[model samples]
Target: MKEYLALFVIIAVFLYLTYTIASLPGSDGLPGNGGYISDEVWYVTSARNILHDFFKTPANSPYYTTTLDCLTNESRIVKEYVNINAVTVTGNVKCYIRRGFPYPDKEGILSYYNFEHPPLAKYVIGLMEAIHDEPLFWRIPSMVLGAATLILVFLSARRVTGNLWALAATALMIFDNTFRAMSGIAMLDIYLAFFTALLVYLHLSGRLLGVGTALGLAASVKYSGVFPLFGLAYLYGRRGVWGFVAVFLMAMSVFTLVNMPIAGQLGIQRWVHEILAAISWHTTSRPPGPIASNPLDWLCMHNSFALYTSPDIYASGTPAYLVALVYALYKRDDVSILYLSTYGGYWLVYLLGNHTLYSFYTTHFSPLAHILIARLLSDIARRK
Candidate 1:
């Protein structure tokens, strides 16, 4: 009964926080049209385009007024395109409706706007856009998932730490500017964070199948989701080699299934090209920007990316929070291994190339870090 009450408290607090975030002046979609909150331009716009593509909303259709389809594949040249609000351009890089596919109906999975990233999160945003195509509507999924993420953090942490510790950690997570900022936006990292926390919850529940599914969902949001699989497989390996392999196979199957909507439309040739193109885009580095930061910078809580101004929301960390996460390695347990693999995954990507990582990406670590912090605090309290 007490636990149930605590969960209610968590929900209430998050509801208040999410509301506060949404009420910000520019919390809507693009700048000038509503306001700027960073990547909402890309993710929200891509989601709008995906909604139009999946439904074949024609160029002449009145539904296009919802501002869903941002890019029309009329021509390769920039001037020939109808760029809605120009959300697709980032520095010199441009997002296009790909393969010379003539817009909505003729589009394939790989030809959709922002096809550089996987489609699951966009599909989620697209589904919401169908309701009304408003800015807040596109962000609803992220807000709900963000709330679910905190609840998952509490539940998963409660298994290993005191209820007070779990509750406190969950509260602190929402207060975290980075996590909070991501939580209230129409962006991809919040989905990735939710799945990562769900993975931990399922892992603790000893449900290998659910763990695999969560991993697939996470990877579907961003390629970095694949990193935790290595840690999970190793932990499962302790049971047997086959446990490891089953987790891997199940995750692969789930990932393929998640992409089936897009992949089914791609045919054989475009699917192959997409696979290779995605790999190259993720691995390759381009011009350094102000928002980019290194893993070391993240740990030190230095140089956080400024996602928005005025009612400022910075995607960043404090030195102590990251230190607590690092300290958890002393536990030498499954959670520790998971944290190592997930954070190390980012470091590995940085080392291999891809210097454009933003501080907002830290959303993925918030769940694992909070759980670790709860345990650390619980241990300290007991020692005292």
Candidate 2:
């Protein structure tokens, strides 16, 4: 009964927080299509374009695009073209009222110009786009998944310190600026965070296939997930090195399967090339821009990325929680060190030349850190 009550309170709290944030006077974009916070412009655009390229869907429905209407022979513009999605569209002036993403890229690469990352998350966004092609629709999937992930946090923490501490973990996650920001935006990190939380739960639950599948899905959302792929395999190495290789291959196979849609469109060879190019794109870095922060900056939640304004939705870690994590590590907490060590992967990326990283990347591990931190406190209370 108490567990049920705790769950109810958490759910109520989550709903209230989300409703309040969305009601805030933030950038609402143009009327009808909802707001474009942070990378929603890039990610949501890709999702809509993917819908058009893949299916020409939400066709002839009421959607809107800022992409100007093309003047035709009647307007005497002759042969002027508008470059959209980096593809030249000739004499194309479809009504943006199609209730789907923008028109497909002319080249049919179907990448929608955001081809560097894997497409599963975009496909997820596309699912919402198919329903109603708007920013709210694009964002709906993330919020739903974010809500679902709270359950994962609760269950994962239950394994650590039973129901009360599990509830504590969920509360911390709900309030964390980074998690909350990612949850509401239509971007890649929240999907990665969902898979990451699943990995943690599957890891604690000792489910083999679940771990492998979570690893693949996590990596598919962002390459940062690859860190946990190896981490989990090493944990499974207790079985044998061959078992480790097998687990790694199983996860990679799922990753390849996730990319099959791209291969189906681009052909197998081009798809392979695209995947390699994406890997290179991730590892390589450019000049440090204002938005980019080093991996270490995330430890104390410094250098937050502003996802939205008016009041500012800064993507950052919680300082008090991070301090708690460090103290747990000082006490030789194995779980603390295990989860925190994942930062070593980012440090390696930093050392191996990629200097421009973002603190928002902590979404990959922050939830797990919170759950384990809750368990640590729960343990202390029991000892006392």
Candidate 3:
């Protein structure tokens, strides 16, 4: 009875937090005045295009139409490509479409496709668009996934510490400005975070299959997820070598399936080429006015990325990260060691990467930080 009540309370809290996040002012997917970000325009547009293709000509339609030279910039371009307007070159990027228009859609389908990021996250956003083509609807998946992540954190912490510590960790996660802001947006990082947490929980629970599935799903959202597999390999060594192989095969299968529409249409060689192209773009391309920080500065929160300005939404996990780092070093137990090493491995990738360091990248470390903090607090209480 007590356990059931505790579970109920935790679930209730999660629901409340999710609702609060979902109800924020700019949760809707619009442009201008606390509307969707520039990246969201692409995500929502991609999703809408994919859905249109699936329903309109699922059997033989092309995965994506070529980028048509279109004129006029309006939200309507997100649904259809128009060639009836005058084209004017505005700037260096050569704007075929008017400013503020999310363009290049022909016949209610996207004119151009983004093979840069993995397709799974866009597919999710597309599903939401299919359900209800609204900003709130588009953000629903992130909200739900973010809430689910909290539940997983609570359960995992409960297993390691106790109800009190679990509650503490969960509360902190709930109030994390970065997590909350990302969850309320139509972005890919939240999905990555949720699957990463699920992978950790499944591994800790000794569910090899679940771990593989979670890992595959995580990677499908973003390539950054592959970092955790290294930690899994270290923890589950030769004794679990077969299971590790299973994880790899499962991850590859999921990756292939999620990308099948585009890959199948493009052919395997072309698909691989496009993927490499995306990687090259990231490595070489620089944002016109880059707002990025070095790894050390990002870690110290010297330069945090602002997700929102009016509402003052910035991603800063330095405080919790510092506390957790200290706790992990002091404890050095199996759980602490695992969490610390996994975090270090993930952080190292970002630290060494040549790409810009955005604040949301810290989402990968948020869950581990919460667990470490909870364990430290629980330990202190017991000693007292």
Candidate 4:
């Protein structure tokens, strides 16, 4: 009990310091700098668009046909050839007359963003907008999820090893400057980390049904939820057909239930149509600049420091890094660290090929590294 209390106090202090450091003029704002990034602009617009159903407000709408239609269209002459500035069309344009985002009032302007990622993220942002109608409001939930991710790390570490290591793991995640920033922002990556850790915890604790439900929620947040699904499938590969079926049904049921309201309100086909429209926007979206076109461009760009660095920097060293890490922990094969590494590494591979990959993509890898680093630290302590 005394040890747990001490751990809690230490964690609380780190969290406070983290928040304080992040609050420094340029910290709390978001993706690129103190201000929100382009993706955040889209997320905010999408959230506002969702409110069009209830309030008819267009303040944050991403569509060109809304508040800024005239300007969005006029400026769109340049947007057309610019690639990154292209607009997306949605069924909501006709049904709600809500128009496109960012450049909401323009007719031909379209978003380069696509719905392929998953609708749940938009729904989350939208729900927050419904309440506060502010970007900061939408950011609140991700912050909570981020803090919860730390709590889960602590708990999971204790379960896998013991309390001492759990406290150390939690501390590492709290101080890891990048994770600190990502958790405070409104993006989906932190949420993805939260869900991945959650699903793993539930599965380890013998709550298979909870694992399915959690994964479904995770999938709804981002396409990366598929990584957790794969992890579970691999873990349960030989458990039995019935086990697989039960898990699948639980996950699918939760996913469908959450999506039902949106599908019903928009019409199932129209909902799917908007989703497809979003996907097309993303895939065809133009490269931001030459520096953004290649993964190596990350090195030269100085302003947005977060966008450039990540575990991929270690890819060339994977033979020495991941290989060594794997061999050293060979005895912990049944542990969650292995699964976290597997899923995180899998995403890193996909990101390497994505010419559009940004800094936040590294969030996908942090949760896994958080645990393993703690384990490594523990191993060193034991040797000492």
Per-residue alpha-carbon lDDT of candidate 2 for residues 1-384, written as tens digits (9 for 90 to 100): 888787878867776666555444333343333456666666776776767776566423343332345323432211111443221122344433223333332333234547778888988887787776555566677777777788888888888788888888788887688877777777898898788888788877877677778888988887777776545555666567875676577788999898887688889888888878877777788775658888767776788887767676788777645665576567544345446556567877788777778877877777777777677778789999
What are the candidates' C-alpha RMSDs? 6.8, 4.7, 6.7, 7.7
Kindly give the number of clashing pairs for every candidate.
0, 6, 6, 30
The 10-residue segment of model 3 with minimum total lDDT is 57-66
Q: Which stretches of candidate 4 lie over 4 Å from their true place?
A: 10-38, 54-114, 270-332, 336-353, 379-384
Find the number of clashing residue pairs for candidate 1. 0
Estimate, for each residue in 247-328, the C-alpha lDDT of model 4 and write its tens digit: 7889888877867756777688987787676545444535575223222222232223332132111111111124224533
Give the Å shift of residue 118 in candidate 3. Answer: 0.9
Candidate 4 or 1, higher TM-score = 1
Query: CA shift at 5, candidate 3, in angstroms?
Result: 5.4
> How many Å off is the CA of 95 in candidate 4?
17
lDDT of 3 at 165: 90
For this target, which candidate reaches the highest lDDT against the unseen true structure? 1
Off by over 4 Å in 1: 25-36, 57-112
Query: Weakest 10 consecutive residues, lDDT, candidate 4?
Result: 311-320
